[model samples]
Target: MTTLYRSLRVLTPAMSETKPSVRGFHGKTSASTDLLETVGRVFLTGRARAHDYMVHVGIGWAPARVPGFRWSAVTANVTDELVQWLVLDGYGFHQAYFHPDRYVRGQYRERRFPWPAGGPGWYVDRAIDQGIGRALWFVAGTDPAVAADLIDGFAPDRRADLYSGAGLAATYAGGVERHELELLWARAGEHRPLVAQAAAFAATARVRAGLAVPHNELATRVFCGMSVAEASEVSVRTRPSGPVGGDVPAYEVWRQRIADEFRASGRA
Candidate 1:
């Protein structure tokens, strides 16, 4: 509750005034996760009223400039900072949903992502790619092959994060059947571990929030080669305890560890 209160205090007047149901934050899962999405939704709601640059700037500011903490209170209960990458997932989703031609079909890349000053721009691009991958699942009508083909259209270097994003969507948003999931798994090729890692992340989110369903199970089995419980467990077990100092963020390290675990278990 303290976390929730602190997070609430940080919101801008416009965001704080908007009356979202308190009930949405009632579960045992981290409110931080929901806040991450909530802030994005708030910006999305203002997209039409604000210029595109301003909206992007707002989303970028929420995490670092908010009160009550150095980081956004949205990250309070998160065990892994890596999940912070989801911040950009909404941006990718918005662009793809509205302008499929430029973002999806044309495969446009943002050269100047003007947010979170001083952070690595290259990493920002990859984080955005994760969102693009998630959006691909929807843009492709949940067809695994079409999504895979769309991801394939990108440079080979970008495909891993793209596949990882798709894996998250397939597991969490789940519209495809078991066979289709298998096809996606097969399609991921060398990036199968990244796919499994993302599936595990999705399973962790679903299971933690008590939102796990049958399709989650099927995707976990196909992509993570484990039951939903086991996949979530893998995510939890491998999470770093605190800050990690390296060229790569602890989030990527967490992801790599999960992927390595899956590979070691022959699930990847």
Candidate 2:
């Protein structure tokens, strides 16, 4: 059986001991390592069936991460359906991050470690989401034209909903919300190979679309996971935006802001 398909097979209670750790909030560790191990194993194997099941689980657990709330209350609230979606969605994100070709120079690198220079796409947030989105778009067999529309539709509108609420901020931040789309695509599996191909296309599209700012220098620093302010210092022409709202500011603006706040609080 394909590694993914085999992962779809539910494990018995006896198999629990083999799973990975499922750490929770407040540094509390759960004894569910067996469950996580099984899930992780299936996830790493890259099987379509496994991905499909995981997507279902991921969706269910998604609500736990809602804004202005504690996940603790919602963690145990997970239903079997939610678990399925979470697993799938998580896997989709993982694939985008770890896919061999997507890696720097077509090589797999440990995600826990920092990426090498001249690595894959710019903007960790953009790269990760775009990769996940492309994977889902592929699984959905979305025509390039339609996929383009979908991406446009989902693109964050900083003006309209930027500071409304925590949920809105989270969505705009493009973290977990982006992963959910990936989960949906994995479940459908319209055409698997399309995932990788679409990711490449999306990366190119981002540059052309100007979603990536200050293309030359900003792209480099972002890909390396450097802060916007840091990149701006070295490249005078690159005036990047603050981590939060506001127009693109000079690097010193942020530096001074930090200094002033620290001084006022007597923490500088």
Candidate 3:
């Protein structure tokens, strides 16, 4: 699979360049419109109205004719309300699938803690930190320079918390349990672009397939020392079968059966 990632720093004039792309597929505006609307309703109120915000936009896709190849673009804006909404909400284009946890309504924790208390700038800064970390992980494994760039992107006081969360998120989303985060930190000097390349490809696939995209079975299996064929089969079994709401339980049963087969074959 081929994957690519690019980063652009948001500037004033550039914000106007990113009007929403024309809708694709079913002729609706791109999925981002829905996200932006939701975000605008939730946070653009009261004293927060006057705050300037930064927005990060990421696009990932596999061309229709391409099977395993993928590409991604990450763009940002300083004034785009849509971008601000995503950053503030701690959700991105892929939030439906890739967020560390599910979104819950009315779940406000006190901002007494310094970590979440940076006010309007807090979410924007967090988004920047995450964008940089993901970008670095996509391009350079755990290179020190990448880590340094992540640190430099934020205020000195916020570095530890921001990178720590970013690292944990990557480890989980990459399906690396155990010491994956530590390993990443230890290898912070290595020149491993494959990590980023794989992520770019996976991101593209996710964009094309949306929630239909299976989690990274190959990576999960590798971490668990399972065979590629076993992992592939597991993925196929887990995919939804037939139309929506049809045979959903049966699909899950098939997934379990495939898991059993992998175990019996000593491939799990």
2 versus 3: better TM-score goes to: 3
The TM-score ranking, best first, is: 1, 3, 2
Model 1 stretches astray by more than 4 angstroms:
1-82
The TM-scores, one per candidate, come to: 0.72, 0.20, 0.26
lDDT of 2: 0.29
User: Which ranges of candidate 3 are over 4 A from the true structure?
Assistant: 1-56, 59-119, 138-156, 160-182, 185-215, 218-268
Candidate 1 per-residue lDDT over residues 37-126, each given as its tens digit = 454454435533223222332343344334435453444443324555555664565455445678878988877655334455567787
Model 3 agreement with the true structure over 1-268: per-residue lDDT tens digits: 0021122212111332212222111112334234333323332221122222211232221111122222111222223332333232233222211221221111112232121122243344433334334433322232334434544454555444334333423432442333553354444322222222223223323333332123344343332243334443444544445433332333223334544554455433
Instruction: Give the per-residue lDDT digits (tens) of candidate 2, residues 177-254.
Output: 223434423332322222222222223323333343342222222221233333223232222353333432232243
The backbone clash count of each candidate, in order, is 0, 24, 2
Instruction: Indicate the residue-level lDDT of 196 in model 3.
Output: 26
Off by over 4 Å in 2: 1-128, 156-268
Q: Each candidate's root-mean-square deviation in Å?
A: 10.0, 20.2, 18.2
TM-score of model number 3: 0.26
The predicted structure with the larger TM-score, 1 or 3, is: 1
Q: After superposition, how far is residue 19 of candidate 2 from its true place, in Å?
A: 28
Per-candidate local distance difference test: 0.69, 0.29, 0.31
